[model samples]
Target: MTNFPNPDENHASARAGWEHIFRGGDIPPRYRSLAEPNPQVVEWADTLPAGGLLLDVGCGVGRHVVYLGGRGFRIAGIDISPTGIRMSQEISAQRQIPFEGHVSPMTALPWPAITFDGALSTSAIHHQRRADLVQALAEVWRVLKPGAVFIADFPSTDTLDYQDMRTRVAAGQLTEVEPNTFVDESTSPDPMEDLFLPHHYCDAADLRDLLRHFEIVRLQADLRPVTTAQGSGKVGKWVVWARRPMTT
Candidate 1:
C-alpha cells in the first residue's frame, strides 16, 4: 500500500487553499464560466425521480444546488471550505432558492445513512490521496439510498498537468506521494492553480477499482477546452454515472 499524508493534514491544506480562494473577491473567470449547469449533469438529473432529494458533494458556491433546486429537486450540498459554503448560501439566498448547505469533508459526511436519493460531484474528489478517496466514496455510498444514482468526474491521467507531474516525478523534481497523485506546486498567476493542493489522476482501471461497489451506467473520457493564466488547453476528465445496488 502507498503511504499518504495524514488525513487531517490533507484536509487542512485543502480547506485553507479553498477558503482563501472563496474569500478572495471575484473568483477566476475560468471558474466563473462554470456557473451554468454541466450538460452531462443535466441529462442524468432529468432521468432521476421527480423532486428526488439530492446531495451535491463538494458543491462549491452551490451552482448545481441552485440550478437543480430551481428545477424542483430538493437539494443539499457540502464542502470542506466554510467560505465556499457561505458563498453558496449567499448565492442561494440572492436567488431566493432554498438550499441546505454544510461545511464538511467528503470523507466524513454529516448526514445519516440512506439520506439522499442521488448525489453528484464535479471538479472535486480527485483532490485526495487514494485512501481518502476510498473513504469519501464509502461515505457517499453509505448516505445514498439503494439504487441511487451518482454522477462525478475525475481528472484523467492524460491531462497535461498529470503528464507534467509524472515527468517531474521521474526527474526527481517532485514526489508522487501515491500512484498518480502529486501535490500541485504551480506558480501560475491564477490563485486556483497555485493553491499547492494534491491532485490524483486516474485511468480506466483505477476508476473501475475505485468504483467497484457501484454498478456503472456510463464511463467515458471527456475533453473540454479551458483558458487560464498559464494558457489555453483542453482539460481531460473521466465522467462516470453509477448506481448503488438495490440489494446489498
Candidate 2:
C-alpha cells in the first residue's frame, strides 16, 4: 500500500504514463480506462450487431475510438486527464478519425441519459474511491439506453500480482511515496513505468454489488493468465459484461 493516503484527485501524469507504457508493453493501455476489459473485447464486439453509437468512457489515447472508427462505427471517448486528451487528439488528427475526445471526469458525463446504444470502458475505474465508483456506475446506468450493453474491466485484489505487491510493500522494498500512488516500477530503468499507480481492487462480490442496476451477461474473475514483468502466471485481471434492462 502507498504510505500516503489516497489523494482526492489522481495525477494526470500517471494516467498519461500508463498510456505510453501500454504501447511499450506493461499492462494494456486501456486498463486505466475504468475497467480491466478482457483482451478479446474487440472480437466479441465484432460478433455483435453493428450500427450503434459506441461510448468509450475514461478513454485515454482513444485506441477504442480508432479501432471502432476503422470498422465504421460512430465512436466518442472521454477522459479526465488533459495529457490523455491531448494524446488522443493527436492520434485522432493523424488518423482523421471522427471522434470527440474530451477532458471530462467519467463521474459526470456531458451527454443525456439513455443516449448511447452501447459502451465499453477498459481498465479505468480503479482510480475512483468506492463511494465515487458507485455513483459513477449509477450515472453510467442512467446514460445507457435500454438494451444497451456495457463492458468494463477492473483489477482484483485476489490476484497473485496484487499479493506480490503487498509482499513487497510489507518487506519495505517499495513505499507509497504519494497519496493514491506508489513508487515501485518508477525506480526501474525502463522508461515505460516510473512507478505503479494506486488501484482500488474489487473482488467479484464487490463488482456484483457495484453494478446491481445492470443485468450481468458475463463476469470473469481471473480474466486471463497472470501477466507480469517476468512472465505469465495463472491468473491476473477480470472483465464484466452487462446490459441495462430493456425496460429499466
Ten residues in sequence with the least summed lDDT for candidate 2 = 29-38
* Candidate 1 off by > 4 Å: 1-4, 25-27, 32-34, 170-174, 185-195, 224-235
Residue 100, candidate 2: Cα error in Å is 1.3
Candidate 2 structure quality by residue, lDDT tens digits, 144-191? 889888888887766666666566677875554432223554445335
Report residue 247 deviation for candidate 1 (angstroms).
Answer: 0.4
Per-model C-alpha lDDT, please? 0.83, 0.68
Q: Mind sharing the TM-score for model 2?
A: 0.74
- TM-score, each model? 0.88, 0.74
lDDT of 1 by residue, 144-217 (tens): 99999999999898666676777777786566777788874444324546326678889999999999999998
